[model samples]
Target: MLRSVFLLTLCASVALCASEYRVKKASRASLNRLKRLINEKTEQQHSDEKKLIGVLDDSPLLVRDPTAQRHHDELAVNNLDEYFQGDVELSETQVEILEKEIVESAEDSKARRRRKVGKAPLYKRWDRTRPISYDFASSVPYSTRIKIRQAIQLWERKTCVRFQESGPNVDRLEFFDGGGCSSFVGRTGGTQGISISTPGCDVVGIISHEIGHALGIFHEQARPDQSSHITVNYRNIPIGRWNNFYPVSLSQADVFGLPYDAGSVMHYGAYGFATDPYTPTITTTDKNLQSTIGQRAGPSFLDFAAINIAYGCNQHCGYLPCRHNGYPNPNNCSECLCPDGFSGSICQYVQYTSCGAHIAVSQDSVSIYSPNHPYQFDSNSECVWLLEAPPGGKVFLEFEDVFQFGCEDTCDKSFVEVKTGPDFRVTGYRFCCSTRPTKRFQTLGNEMLVLFKGNRERSRGFKARVWSDVSPIFTTTSSTTTAATTTTTVSTTALTTVAVEESTTERLSVAVSHGVSGKEVAVKSVADAGNGSARESVSKRIANEKKNAHATSWFVLQERTF
Candidate 1:
């Protein structure tokens, strides 16, 4: 499973130490010296929009856990003179920037080959013009080779980067079976060896993750801005491994203006470094999204975007607009990254029937229906309706009849969502998928997006209408009981029939809106509200006694004086 080993680190420390937190002046100086060295070769100044602001300064030495033992499969490389993260081996010049005291030594340490100085920048990306080459060691099984091919295909399908078989004499990646799965970030030059240990490091997602590191992107949570989205439960982390929670500085990263994606394959899981089952090492601000932190289901859309951006693949459009909800793809400038709901060259066409018709509201009121409504909607159909109210006014949406899609936690299978404002950053509501009833919804701004999506599961579509609301709406509710039966009369522009049994004390709410005729009857099936609880009860009663089915129920009606 993707969650099983997602973001699991390779190394384990020997013992826990005392709590010693300090920002050493020498460490900062070391970092500054490395930057100065890189700047002399090629000084690349990122635009403000693409820059990452460092939120936390390097500080406090973390206490390693004393009880934890190292995994037998993991190769201990802590003794190396310089390593950027724990896994990536640094160049001779790069290694010199690390403070000597902090660099631990392993028992089997040897003098590494010293390469000539004057390389490109420390974080120099791979050349997109040239293909990355790789060859498998003889020990690698056929299954592992196939998995590696699949991972490469995934990247090729999404990005412009290509992976080719390494020739005998060329400098390329040499995959070998070793202690544990690990790879250097980006191109380290020459023949770089990526280890994929036998038994444990066999999963395709794990291989893809290591490949991602080799492609130049770091862990998603390693970004400095991640703290705002996810909280590090340092207490639950293994002792001496607190440094794993530390993020890289802003100068060391480029966000490219993308939002922090929890579902990215590069993100660590909630229990990634957890010391115990009950404690989680990572927690999200939105608790519901914690499970998504270490999702290794494959690289997310943003991950693909980041790769294209880093490799300079999205240069074709030259800032041309992609209409509708289309995002420009860095790999192909002429193409766009359109969601499932839309299509076309610029994503102007609505492909999925479930994405219903695109209707723009410019008048006082307008109504919309699902594709082939009165009947069930098509499978995999997604409909989007854009509603724009009068200038300086808000939109009021009322669903005269809404069927299909029972309430669930996330309306994942099928549901409608409302987004408010110009950018639609504020989610108005995700309805028909939870306990919350879809009542009349009013937007806070002039624009609102009503999106309806349906899966293969069939259900009668919804019919809704929206109107401009110059001011906010207010409502009054009162109840009165008659002698014969506990009759409740609800009044509005139209008459709505709602039958409630006096014997059973069930809370029933009935909402009615004014229609074209001013005396029209609005019919809302009992199944649409309370997720069919009321409808089930009515069906049971009808099945038990067929005679009472003919007896009509009375509705309390209030005549509008207007």
Candidate 2:
């Protein structure tokens, strides 16, 4: 009987083992099927996103309407759902405050038609004493998270503001994949959501721009003084979209005394909200700056300065002596936050790039040219030349020879920028076309900064002459001038009037020959009264003479010596 019981127990144990093996096999198969379904769904989502991006690319607007399903539907109505001024998301309280301000402003304007003064817009600033808390939603793509982190790093590096991840139930910024790129301006006391659309809003500059709005900074063109810099062409815009071009009152937006920056990333592009793609909705007062208005290259130097001022970052090192309009750096009090094309501990030197130099100006003019002048310059080259004059003196700059580079409306790709204003913090005059500048540039102070940026397109560079003038003479002169009986000496970069002999003849003949090919570029005869002042005649004769009429050939100029 004991032997029979042992055999029965063995049979039962084998049956239990077989049952367990079959159950394990079925579970493995089920897990494999679940993984396959997940992968297929992910692939489909990616494909749909690609198709959406293709549609978005065809639209002229950079920022899309988060509420609309189709791009064209964005223009269907004047007001977007839950959005202010197109892409700014505002809380109910903030919206109420804005509407009240607008109504009051309209009433005030009606009361004072002769002198319109609108109240400042309401802006809630984030607390600067503590680190800004931020977090990502599960839906945010990993790649987008990386871009947001990079933008945060840049802002932290440039300013004194700090940012960190948030804890549970804390007031923080939540980044999620909204239908389009949008964010609330400044802190809203609770969890503020920043929508960073995938694929469409992946650019670093675009990301930084949205973050800028969240930092209590409005659109550059929204400032009260925007009318002085940019003109809004309402005819090119639809009636419903006119609200996008409305200016924020001075009281509403505090600029911290910074100048209006056309290159600010917050500014709209030329064709923004335009009814016609070829026609621009906005035109800059400074025609050269038309292309610079809507740039997504990141924040301008003044943009950073304004943020520092707004957040009280400038107070940290108020006593620090920073030069060239540079402010003391909040990150390191010992250093300074220098402007573009400027560097050094106190910003007393020119920024060093692949090719550049610190040039000293004297009474005698000196020639400066792009690296490899008279030939095609290298791509991706940045050169900065700091022209410093004696104390109480002024620096004069003139473009002499052929000026050629990659031409764009914005000069985004390649250009030559000259910062001649007293405030070095603002963007300088940029020239990118083949046409040489006709007007000479002079600085208000003793210093001038020249920056040359070259991109993928390599073309013949430029030649310029710089000098120091002690007298305060700020005048614009034509490149072509007429004078009598002058001995013209021309070179590749300079033209010196060796001697101007007094001649009795009323007709003065002048000839300018190219230094390279030895070909006569310009020959002219002028009828001037011999009684005219020698100083006037001598100064007028010295001008840039172009060779071969084509921009490819080198240019020579005649210099005036009194």
Candidate 3:
């Protein structure tokens, strides 16, 4: 008895949940009115499922006159029975709702008569949960299934809504072989049918187009503002087919402020509904673009933007710092897919720039400031500074009071470059957008190039001082008997560039007994550099050189060739 009572309670719970999602029934009067207008005589007499099928198979006259019956071929794919309102398939509930809206529009039509009469959109949408569910029929081949999955992925990548496989008990899309390729606009409550007729509907683009309709988007040409951009030649259309070109009201069509896009994936081709195959039916404002319209390649950028706007995908990002560099991904709003050379959680990092001023610095010391020094720097600029030290010296650079640019590791946006040589051929130390300034950069070579560049644009570039400082001279005189007591002096120097005060250190002199190549040469310290301020400068500079001693090599040695 207890078990029986539990089963009964569970059944009740399921029924309650089902009722929440059930499609609301239209009033008998409203349904009857729509049936008369559309000429679906058996609509009220049939079952719900039968009624839907009947609507799909019927096509009523939309105009007073139509082409001759001899010319109207029933086998044509573009026949009026293909869809209602050109390609949209409306449910009974939708038709009733549309009737009510039509009544309201007629009452307001007089007031709005003086306003613009451009076509508007139909506003009815799906009653779907956040992510829509879909499943395939057992007869769907693996190859076809792959294509359909790809279509779903394409939409998922662009829009906030997601599509996932559904279980047996849930409302979902069921793909099956039908008379033709088609899908109902938005959701139709329970398990909906999306025809994937083989041979004709096997293309990737076609699959995406059908899925777009199921996602609640209408055709691009059916947009309310289409009249402003293209000419729909009704003369080329058949009499009863005029409903195919019916304009939707602005209230029904939620365009989300996007412009008319003729190249949308949801658009039909130029010959969409041509009464005669040779005559064009849809013409664009610019005749040259006629061929470019009605592309079924994939969703355009605007299409993605509109879907994102509809689902508030970007808004889901909350306080994330994605600005000019990136748009938040709909799937994962916290993460972002940044443009090339940009990275980080919010796409704040810039890699490098190719524009600026070129500066060659060969002086003992020079101060380099951004273009328009104190003011903001120019956009798309490349500036280079070449610093040459004394014959045996290195270049010392330090940041001044101001330094700023778009921050990144490679400094792609705005940055300061300090290189080993006076050109960009080699790698260098690059500094970009950051609150902490760079203290110093001392090059091993006598010549160094400092490049400054800005990618797009930003404020107060950067100010830096470059000074050429000589390492404490270490003179080594080696006498060789073969060359009449020839003397060679070897000097080892260190890099001493600082952001603070200017000072130097003492030099170290060493005595060396030279030997033949590949043999070890003995060396001994001979004397300390001179004392006092002069010696202190040399000593300080020498100390700086020691700090980088581990990094020293033959590259730091200065010598003369005989």
Candidate 4:
């Protein structure tokens, strides 16, 4: 597809003869505007080139009523839907512009200096700690699994392994070999691992740690009492520095000395992993575990001791008691604790989709805040941030990509307006990655685009609203407030109609006054239906234009069907 579809909005005054895009929803309203746009631009081009003076110009360089063209517009730009699996190629100049924007955006998004400070840890070392793997969906690190498999092999040299009655629960774990590594175990648990793709170093420690978990070792960060885990007190940090920078919220397990193993494999260098709002950034003191963190690439003595007690190795034992609920409940959590569109403790309720009770659609400027941010994923995730904004209201979707103000990149997004029920539907969206060396829009989650229309399908009971967020692709653990500025004003629903005469030569405007996008066969025009305000504006404008055009009383032969 021609990237000009995007660059044209920037470089040219008229859209191409036609273009291919991503959204699939057939918006009768948006199509109307688009059709007019096509006509206005094309007619100007034809008239300029066919500059025939007067009498000879009877060849009639023409711009006529849109009535007949509404059906034609149906097959125009908006109806062309094809799979977007390949390169949505952009021009060389567009690529340079995009790459430059990405670098600049990164610089601007790096938090304030004060926020960046204290990111390093003062003094810390990995404390050998054993952990239990109650991985619900098997949330094990790739490296951790390697070590577990290796240990099973080592342990099985004498006998077949039986970690689980059903084969070992290894999913997508990674492995790491202990080289001249300076990795040390930490006192708590938050996600931590080396980039190594081997089982010896990266995965070894985790396997031992998870075994510790099977044997029933809780994470060090879950210290029962805040006073026991560390001399310095702070919250948990997941990524970067400053993790655990705030006061940590204690879980039930943390309050009870589940078991303390200084050399257990479960320990991370810093205790920021399990905390909320995550210690904003990485800490300065945070360091990796030394190569000898586990003493011999295995769990510490305490690890074996605890496992022996929790579940007898040869006994096929039952697990030690778990104090907290084993599963996550997305609803019980605060907005800060949840992912973009997820809420509750486990984040099962999708606030943006029908998974939630109702959804509101609105339009606003979407751009990248940081180059490091996966724009597509970030945009897709920015939804939950607005979950409670318009708790109960309709939506008005707009299409514009400007990266001024706080944003860093000009977003190349699309919209697909759906009409599932009366006022229930979603505008689809799919965000692209940096349009750079690799010119591909990286898709993240399900968010598509924003759309607004009344309950055209089922106008009575439930209103299931939907939309998409296609922007860029980093899935960060921060920046959830990018959509607070978005505003969706509900419109007035007065149904006033107006008409115009065909004698007018100026561009006549129409008021699709209510949420409506359709062609006016009587006046070769199409209008977009939307939130009451926009529709009203379109309707009133059309009405006034009709009045002025008819002041000369010319018969409009093409007034009723397009």
Model number with the top lDDT:
2
User: How does candidate 4 score on lDDT?
Assistant: 0.24
What C-alpha lDDT, on a 0 to 100 scale, does residue 332 get in candidate 3?
A: 75
Between the candidate structures 1 and 3, which one is better when assessed by TM-score?
A: 1
Candidate 2 per-residue lDDT, tens place, 1-562, comes to: 4543343333332433222221111132333333344334324433554322222223232122232122121122223333555667654455456555554553233221111111124456677887887777666788989999998887888988788864332445777666677777776655566777776776677778778888877878777666577766665656545566666665566665678788787777666676666566676777656545665667788878878877888785757678888978888888888999887677765675655555545566667677678888889877777776657989999998788876544555678888886798887777666767767888898889988888758988788988887422222212233343433322232222211122323212123322222322222222222335644454343322232113213333334322
* Model number with the top TM-score: 2
Candidate number with the higher lDDT (3 or 4)? 3
Model 3 Cα lDDT, one tens digit per residue, 52-139: 2211102121111122111111112323455565445565667766667655554334222121111123333443245676766655
Least lDDT summed over 10 consecutive residues: which range in candidate 1?
14-23
Runs of candidate 4 exceeding 4 Å displacement:
1-148, 153-161, 164-196, 199-203, 210-216, 233-259, 270-296, 312-562
Could you give candidate 4's per-residue lDDT for residues 103-193 as a string of tens digits? 3432222121111001112111121122221111122344555445676543322211233322121211111222212211221222112
Least well predicted 10-residue stretch by lDDT in candidate 3: 498-507
**What residue runs in model 2 are displaced by over 4 Å at the alpha carbon?**
1-83, 106-122, 166-169, 400-402, 433-436, 455-457, 470-562
Q: Write the per-residue lDDT of candidate 1 for residues 1-562, one digit (tens) a residue.
A: 2321221111011111100110011243454444344333211221232222211112211121222222221113232112233344444444463223123322211111111111135455667787887777665677888888888887887788888874322335656665567676677655556767566666666677677777877777777565567766654644334555555444345666666666566766554545663445566654434434554435666677778777767766566466544567656667677543445556544332323333323334556656666577766776666555446877777776556554332233456666553433222244443222345676666766777767647667676777775422323323344433333322223322233323222222212222222333222333323435645653443232222111111112222221
Displacement of residue 286 (Cα, Å) in model 3 is 3.1
The residue ranges of model 1 lying beyond 4 angstroms of the native Cα positions read 1-120, 167-169, 197-200, 339-342, 349-562
Name the lDDT value of residue 10 in candidate 2: 39
RMSD of each: 18.3, 19.2, 22.7, 32.4
